[model samples]
Target: MADATKNPIADLSESEQLELSKFIESEQQKVKLQQAIHQFTSTCWPKCIGNIGNKLDKSEEQCLQNCVERFLDCNFHIIKSLESTRK
Candidate 1:
């Protein structure tokens, strides 16, 4: 993958450069979101589901939901903490 900060479209026309840049940024954001979702699912799956059943039970479903919510809350808390420390 190319470094997004580097100008990979320098030889392109102005409009083309803008379009490429926007596409690259949108793609990068999509990749990041996918990675985060994979990480969260991997981390929470085993922790939430104890038995290896074919389908998730109600309790298992609730556990998975809570696990994801808690993980997101922790992420937000850490971001807020870092922002406070930066100032």
Candidate 2:
């Protein structure tokens, strides 16, 4: 019997292996996306939200939208800035 702790991939058929690889890749992508969302919310919540209400007011909602846009813009700006210096 194969050890329970051993790599299960070794016992899988080629098709099963391919499916497992694709599943793992998708799961990893989901985890990365979830992490990014958590980071974005954490960073934006304080800057955009105020006075813990039952729901977000329109102003707060707009603030969060703008914050995320600005954050993405900042990331792109930094990437461009670095590329310019590398030349």
Candidate 3:
């Protein structure tokens, strides 16, 4: 018996199963994004900053921004290249 609230996923209709899968995938992506941001902060903060300052200076700001952007750009390029090769 598939109770609406307790379908156990296996009891779902094909479309419902797919919808659930997409929702889970979206949530997983959000978690991955959070992890990436945490990794970026940990990896970039120390490299760009040494002292505890009242405020971040322009160089520190730029350095952090550039560090994260470069990582994202590299990831994007790699993903694109992989997709092209698969195709």
Q: In TM-score terms, which candidate is top?
A: 1
lDDT of 3 by residue, 1-87 (tens): 546676477768999999999999999999999999998999899899978889999999999999999989998999999999999
lDDT of 1 by residue, 1-87 (tens): 868798656779999988988999999999999998997889899898888979999999999899999999999999999999999
Error of 1 at 14 (Å): 1.2
Worst 10 residues of 3 by lDDT: 1-10
* TM of each candidate vs. truth: 0.81, 0.78, 0.67
Q: Cα RMSD (Å) per model? A: 5.1, 2.7, 4.3
The candidate with the higher TM-score, 1 or 3, is 1
Q: Distance (Å) between predicted and true CA of 61, model 1?
A: 1.1
lDDT of each: 0.91, 0.92, 0.92
The alpha-carbon deviation from the true structure for residue 31 of candidate 3, after best TM-score superposition, in angstroms, is: 0.3
State in Å the error of residue 70, model 3. 0.9
What is the overall TM-score of model 1 with all chains considered together?
0.81
Q: lDDT, candidate 1, residue 53?
A: 73
Worst 10 residues of 2 by lDDT: 1-10
Query: What 10-residue stretch in candidate 1 is worst by lDDT?
Result: 2-11
